[model samples]
Target chain A: MTSILASAEELTGGVCCGASVAVPREASGCAMEAVRALVRRRVRDLTLIAVPQAGFQADLLIGAGCVRQVEAAAVTLGEHGSAPRFRAAVSAGTVEIRDSTCPAIHAGLQAAEKGVPFMPMRGILGSDLALHRDDWHTIENPYGENDPILLLPAITPDVSLFHAPRADREGNVWVGVNRELLTMAHASRETLVTVEAISDESLTSDVRLAAGTIPSLYVSAIAEAPRGAAPVGLPGYYDEDTSHLRRYAELAQTEEGFDRYLAEQVIAAPAPA
Target chain B: MSEAYRPEELLMSVVAGLLEGARHVAVGAISPIPAGGALLARERAAGRMRVSILGSERHTFFTDGGRELFDCAAQGRIDAFFLDGAQIDGSANINLVGIGSYPRSRVRFAGSFGSAYLYFLVPRVILVAHEHSRRTLVDRVDFVSAPGTSPPGVYRPGGPVALVTDRCVFGFDRAAGRFSLSSAHPGQSVGAIRDKTGFEFTLDDAVATTAVPGAAALALLRGSVREALQEAYPEFAEHVLGQAA
Candidate 1:
């Protein structure tokens, strides 16, 4: 089955480009709203990953009962956060929370961006962290000659949703100086963007500098909406949403706690007018 | 006699001004100038200045790396905190996530650790960074790591009454929700400060530089860090505590 046992190269797109992506209801819709709509449709099997720094609203997915998994490489406990007592995986449909100082999983997507079989990384060695490998495997570095590195099988999400500082209606994106966003957009086959403002004018108006974080070609759809990363700053617009920070800090720490938080703060909360 | 003035000196000097009298404080990572300065002040001010090192992950420790700092602060003991943002916008919001695109971008620097959560409640916060530019200082941030001014009476991580940058020292104008130029260091100018920010600031005619680390305070810190570290890591003390001077 091409869908079931496809080679690493064939599957996945955006951020983790080796998996299937769920097309949006419309090619162009508000990025976050589209993500919300996607969650509403696949509430049972989905994993959400985004930096909490901008308060990207992971809580919303958790609330819809869609976030079956959380993924971050360098995970920390809450004064006493331990690994989840329950074990979950891609097949099992559980969220794997990965929090590392450097973006490893994101780099996995970058490896996919280059269409490579694996991405080499630093860290994750000399620690017991490599112990939990029921699925993930380590390889003897072919390039480094005997040095071993971990290969996170590239991840292509069902949908890669992002919020940018600015984007064009045709799905062309302008990310200013922050370019790793390119790796993110490239890592997914289908990418969705919610922007601070949309300019029908070519982004190279010369008034604003054009540093490509994501090219229009990579983006599947683009929606212009202000404060899309609201409560989090809009790049050049506003700062984080304090209420969200305060509420999330006080409430979400674990899977269940964070899930409950999403329902009340994001899903049930009134949409911005 | 007054001491000779410079940027590195002023960086440490600001910490002296902010922590000379505070009983307890937290210092974040990357820039260690103020942190090193504050610890020095406590030693000289009759050893009355009790400061703790609080890193981004909410990891609190002493100069010797003991976890006690975290324990004490968690128990509601820390009084002042210093932090930095990835992106500092118009409202003084911070974004430290990877630069470029999202989910898959070129460089994923470091993720935000508790700064957002910490700033919300810490009584005193001091925002610090070496440079403020059109990129660093912005009208708004792509991500909100920590905010200079928060909603009124809204449990704002207290004590962040001042912002110390390489060019100038600043504080928030509660009514305007923007940073006001407090003082430029002895030699620096406001124009120099404005040049580095990604966003604009309200600058007044008089700006002040940070106060220098007086002899007495430096001497106090010099002696204290050594004596304490001598028992734990003697070799490290010789390097970090400045062996001869």
Candidate 2:
């Protein structure tokens, strides 16, 4: 049975120091409230894996000194410009970066989803991205004539965290078109979700919602946190708080500014209702 | 020529011209110009062409998640895509990783998104760098996020076909692994482009001026294209396109 928690802090208790956590991109719902909870708890040495790419959430974790390493395709604040904290950390050599291409990250997670040891992929043959990753292997296709392919090992994270619009009483989360959350759940040891609301009705019972639902079998716990993906949008629910994000981008430019932001936003912030 | 257009409008026109005949074009994040171009091309195609802008709910149709775009590209479903880098060499090699050495970079740009894969799978991978300078258009990138050309025996059907910048257009030759000056943008001279470029490129004796966007194209861009582009890039639509549109 999945544990139904009352708040983001309680749900994030499972997240310990040095745990490998996989998170969704900005387009898909991000677990911002959980990130704040982790920061408030003063969690350290996290290995953050962006499920292809990330933005504000990744930068926040990096700035808060919660992350020891980052494995992602890219981290940028989009139109607001570069992710200042990530750039500063990378330049200062505070965080180890395992640079990856978008598809390679997906391939590795998919490999884990299928319970496979490795998945063979195309492209990345001559890239320095390939050269840097020792875990990635090149193998000749036994069935084809002189064809070489890249094999990526499974990427199974300790925890997969994300925000969603809703979850049912049965703990089935409605991720809608954001199917990467489904993949993340399957690839991680435990799946923790924070939702805008909890429905009394069973999601799997509804035909339309069932298609986009992540069954309770994969979910370890659920927390009810309204506006959980704030600053980042939740598609139909709300638009991205761009002004807030832009302000964050500005404040996160320097260590002093970042510490000020952490104190204002995460540490000294009001608890979610 | 009757109406003055913004530089972004010119760049969008160039991008739309490059996207002609592309059945399915996919634009990535932070690419308002390419997104506008793709939309403009779609309008021109009478909805025949499909344009998928990442992060746009109204534009993208990927229900299977993040990997579906890559999977679709691998299956040859995508005809055209766009990429940019911090440093791009003459051979079309892109450096999206950073400015300095690997691991410990002096300056780090965003890591490579899908460039390493889409640069190989999509038939037309157009490289767009709005900044055309010696620093961006380098002799050799410090890191190769995705190589412009692959060695023999590699199954590569896709690579950079053209490099578009603010000042000019450079057509890439896959066989020779080099770029040639195709056309110079309005007010930009061949001599000026040569002076600014850090890498060497073949220049023809008669370099033509890039065709200016016609009234009809500009009208479509300002009206329908800008309106549709707002769904994805409201800031660009509001600030860049402005009330004139």
TM, every model:
0.45, 0.98
Give the lDDT of residue A172 in candidate 2.
Answer: 94
Cα lDDT of model 1 by residue, A189-238, tens digit: 66666666776666755545455546677776665555555544443456
Please give the lDDT score for candidate 1. Answer: 0.50
Question: For all candidates, what are the clash counts?
Answer: 91, 0
Give me the runs in candidate 2 sitting further than 4 Å from their true place. Answer: none
Full-model lDDT for every candidate: 0.50, 0.92
Interface RMSD of 2: 0.7
Give Cα distance to truth, residue B147, candidate 2, Å: 0.4
Q: Score the docking of each candidate (DockQ).
A: 0.03, 0.87
